[model samples]
Target: MSPMETGLIGIGALFVLMVLRTPVAFAMLITGYFGMLVLEGSRAAGAVMLTESYSTVSNYNLIVVPMFILLGNIASAAGFSRGLYDAAFAWVGRFRGGLASSSVLGCAIFSAVSGSSVATAITIGKVALPEMKRLGYQDALSTGSIAAGGTLGFLIPPSTGFVLYAILTEQSIGRLFMAGILPGLLLMAAFIGTIALIATINPEAGPRGARVPLGQKFRVLVQSAPLIGIISISIGGIYAGVFTPVEASAIGAGLVLLLAFAMRQLSWNGFCRAILETVRTSAMLYMVVIGANVLNPFLAVTHIPETLGNAMVGLGLGPYGTLAIIILAYVVLGMFLDGLSMLVVTIPIIYPVILQMGFDPIWFGVVAVIVIEMGMITPPVGLNVFVVKGVAQDVPMTTVFKGVMPFLLAMIVSLLLIIIFPQIATLLPDLMFS
Candidate 1:
């Protein structure tokens, strides 16, 4: 049989494994290993598996993942996430749909540190959902906002999605992080506007929060300063060229640990738990990376990406037309796959086509991240929605999904703006690096 035919069968087996409830990382690994063994000899297949596994584990860039994850886990254990939510609520809660807006803001802030959508959603939803409920906010709006807002974890700086994308596409992590900034803020603003519109249309859906005195607002902001300061120093250092992303992550984690100890907020038990959680999460991410690395060799041997790129060029649909088609395919995949799985699985195939179409890789990273973010709130496999549902146990899954619709539309609008004017994603990186 031809190599291309073997590759096609391997792809089918990968999907079948996923449908059978096998873990995504294991499924990819299994499919790639067996496909390679069949195409070559057992020696070549074993060498590929061992070499890729070692290289992936030893990769310096990957160190950033564990550090930032530890920073977030430590921050959450120390109650710094709660401080951020309080500060956002104090400042914005008085306006119409203010509580929900504050939730989005809080998610955005926490996302800067967490870099995981599930972590961001659970952290903020725990704080914001109860308050919105107590204040008589509709379940749809309150839960929806948290689910959609958690998606910022994938788009904002220090994003795991961008980290993996950069590693896969051989792009700069700093440039990708910088590219995400404006687009992230644009999406955040769009989410806020969606909340305001919902409240405007149905006053009862989101009532105005009680106004805080100016002094109190300042006090709450002060209380939230430690986490904010760490985020600024770490993420800011990257943009300022003061440090590499790995160094920034180390500094951030160290600072958060110091703050937690100084405040007496993190006990010995809490510290141990944070370490354990970080190891578990980081290990899972590492496995996914290893699987992708192994699978990539198999795909190359089959000439699949090359063949797909050639087919796309033959279509003669201009750049934008081809882009629209790629985005549509991503949305369909997002409905079934989690963000990281989707990234590791598809980028190798789609990336070449993107570059062939003359689109900037950095800009496309931002666009791709946003599309993945949309998937987090999309139905069926909406991971963030499930996270929010876990926090707000009484709220039904359907209500959370309904609440995310407007924000989903907002995402589409923000995506269109970025596509029409690519500079929104590229400007900061261009200015900073140039």
Candidate 2:
């Protein structure tokens, strides 16, 4: 059989494994190993697997994964996430739909350290949902805001999605992080606007919160200052060329650990749990990287990416037309696949096409992340939806999904803005680096 045919079959098997509830990392590993064994000898397959596994784990940049994860885990354990929510609530809770809007702001703040959608959702949802419910906010608005806001974890600076995308495409992590800044803030603003419109249309859906006293607001902001400072020093330092991402991550983690101990909020048990969770999460990400590395070689042998790129060029769709098609494909895949899995699997194929069409890779990374963020709140496999539902146990899954629809529209609008004016994603990186 031809190599392309073998590649097609391997892709089918990969999907079947995922459908059968196999973990994405292992599924990719299994498909790649067997496909390589078929195309080459057992010796070649074994060597590829061993080398790729070693190389992925040993890569220096990957250390940021565990450090950032640890920073977030430690922050959550130490109640810093709660402080952030309180601060956001104090500042914004007086506006119409203020509680819900505060939840979005809270998620965006925590996202700076967490670099995770599920983590951001769970952290902010735990703090914001109960308050919104008690204040008579509708379940749909409160829950939807959290779910949609959680997606910012994927778009903001220090994002895990950008980290993996950078590694996969050999783009600069700093540049990708910088590129994400404006787009992330834009999406956050769009989410806030959506909440305002909802409250304006149906006042009862999101009641105005009681105004916080200025002193109380300042107090809560003070409580949140440690995290805010750390995020600024780490992410901002990278932009200023004062530290690389790796150094920034290490410094951030170290600072968080010290702050936790200083506040006496991190019990020994909590500390241990944070470490264990960090290891588990980091190991999973590393394995996914390894799987992608292994699978890439097998796919190269099949020339699948080359063939797909050729086919795309044959369509005679100019750059924007082809971009629309690619974005549509990501949206469809996002419905079924976890965002990270979608990135690792499709980027090798789609990225070359993007470059060939003269789109900037850094800009495309921001665009790609926003599309994946949309999927995080999309139904069926909406991971963030499930997370918010888990926190607001009484809320139905359908309610959470329903809640995110407006915010989903907000996401689509954000995507369109970025596409129409690529500068939204590229300006920061260009100014900082150039």
Taking the tens digit of each residue's C-alpha lDDT, what string does model 1 give over 1-434? 99999999999999999889888889989988999999987998999999999999999999999999999999999999999999999999999999999999999999999998889999999999999999999999999999999999999988999999998998999999899889989999999999999999999999999989999999999999988999999989999999999999999999999999999999999999999999999999999999999899999999999999889889998889899999999999999999998999999889999998899999999999999999999989999998999999999999999999999999999999999999999999999899
Worst 10 residues of 1 by lDDT: 19-28
lDDT (Cα atoms) of all candidates against the true structure: 0.94, 0.93
Spell out the clash pairs found in candidate 2.
none
**Candidate with the greatest lDDT versus the true structure:** 1
TM-scores of all predicted structures:
0.99, 0.99
Model 1, runs deviating above 4 Å: none
Candidate 2 lDDT by residue in tens digits, 241-311: 99999999999999999999998999999999999999999999999999899898899999998888888
lDDT of 1 at 238: 93
Clashing pairs counted in every model = 0, 0
